[model samples]
Target: MPFAVLPAQICDVEPVYDVYFAAFKNEPIIEFLFPGGGDRKAHTAGTVQWWNHDRNGYTVKCVDTDTGKIVGMASWDIFWRPGEEGAWPKPDGAVWLEGEQRTKAEGVLVPLWEMHEKLFGKNRHVYLPTMAVDPDCQRRGAGRLLMQWGIDIAEKLGLAIYLESTEAGLPLYSRMGFERLTYVHMIHKAEVAGTEEDVEVPLMVKMPSKAKGMAFEDWAKRGYP
Candidate 1:
């Protein structure tokens, strides 16, 4: 079946949250964000709210045309204001982290912010904060279709695209023209003897495509700004 990519509406929040939660339930960053396994659902919901409310980003959903179901989604924003300072803002009502998890998150994010500024440095660009496909919808082309929405816009604007890629997502992003810039490791504190581990997340960027001179009207007709 074919997939149609469209901008998400406010009513799409619940479904998008479901996909995001299920997709990342076992991801290391999710584990770090909501340690102790308590209030996981609430924390995830809070994240969705933050993305929708605080970030004011453009969200695109990939709908399976035959069934009209949203199988994948990606949220992106332009962070181009001059003189913006500090690390990326934490999600509103974010879950609390303690000990190693807090240290690890801070350690990873602080440097990630520095690298982002060093590389892009106030150039107008698209920043992808989240993207995920439904667990049941894996291996379909929905993810690629959703990503193409951002790629199209970035290509038209001649702006770079940036995202932090999880280990599971690196291959897909690489195929989409993103190159790894650096890696951020999040170490899990050992709850049981000899069980500590870490996850490597790569920071990736895709430079704008050479194809340019497309008008806004042309992009809008294709369902993008």
Candidate 2:
């Protein structure tokens, strides 16, 4: 049976976080990183709160026709140029705003925007921060289905998508119509890098709607490398 892509509700937090962690567990070896751990319940609650924020968006997966048991997830946002209504603007390469740049870009001003705009510029880009599938469900096309849902939504909304990836996800994103926008090199604190966490991320971008005519399936196969 096909995994269903659905709007993730606040009640589905636990399972969604489970999938998020499982899908990225190999992140340590794949990219030498992991999100902060422990108190998964609290983390889930926080994530639910974060994703529900007005500036962000998300989609999740569950077994078709069943009570919500989130098996996969993809979260995104609509990029607002710095000077537009509800826009957060910074002078080019401004570092003073660095302390606020969160992954969700809530208070993120410094590091996040500089890094974000450096690649996407001041356009309406679709921001996909996390995409993961449960470990028990790997190799079963769950990730692909979730990703296609993201692509479909992006196309419908007429926005280009942007993301950063660990080593394991590079091929998958490439196949989903994303291209290498730039590479970010990081030197984590030795303690952090030495731990079984800390990931190296490579930023990527999906070709804009106007770029080409490749069918989704064909594009998925060709660039999935």
> Highest TM-score: which candidate?
1
Every model's TM-score: 0.71, 0.68
Model 2 C-alpha lDDT per residue in residues 97-164, reported as the tens digit of each score = 23322222222223445676554444455677678877877677878888888787777765667776
Candidate 2, residue 198: Cα displacement in angstroms equals: 10
Name the lDDT of candidate 2: 0.59
- Native-to-model Cα distance after best TM-score fit, residue 108 in candidate 1, in Å: 4.8
Top-lDDT structure, candidate number: 1
lDDT of 1 by residue, 1-225 (tens): 788899888778778766887898876555545555546566656656766665437888888899989888898886544444422443322226667767655554555566555555544568897999998998888888878898888777666687877778988998998866633332334441123554445777776655244432243244322
Error of 2 at 184 (Å): 6.8
Error of 1 at 27 (Å): 1.0
Residues forming the 10-long window of minimal summed lDDT in candidate 2: 100-109
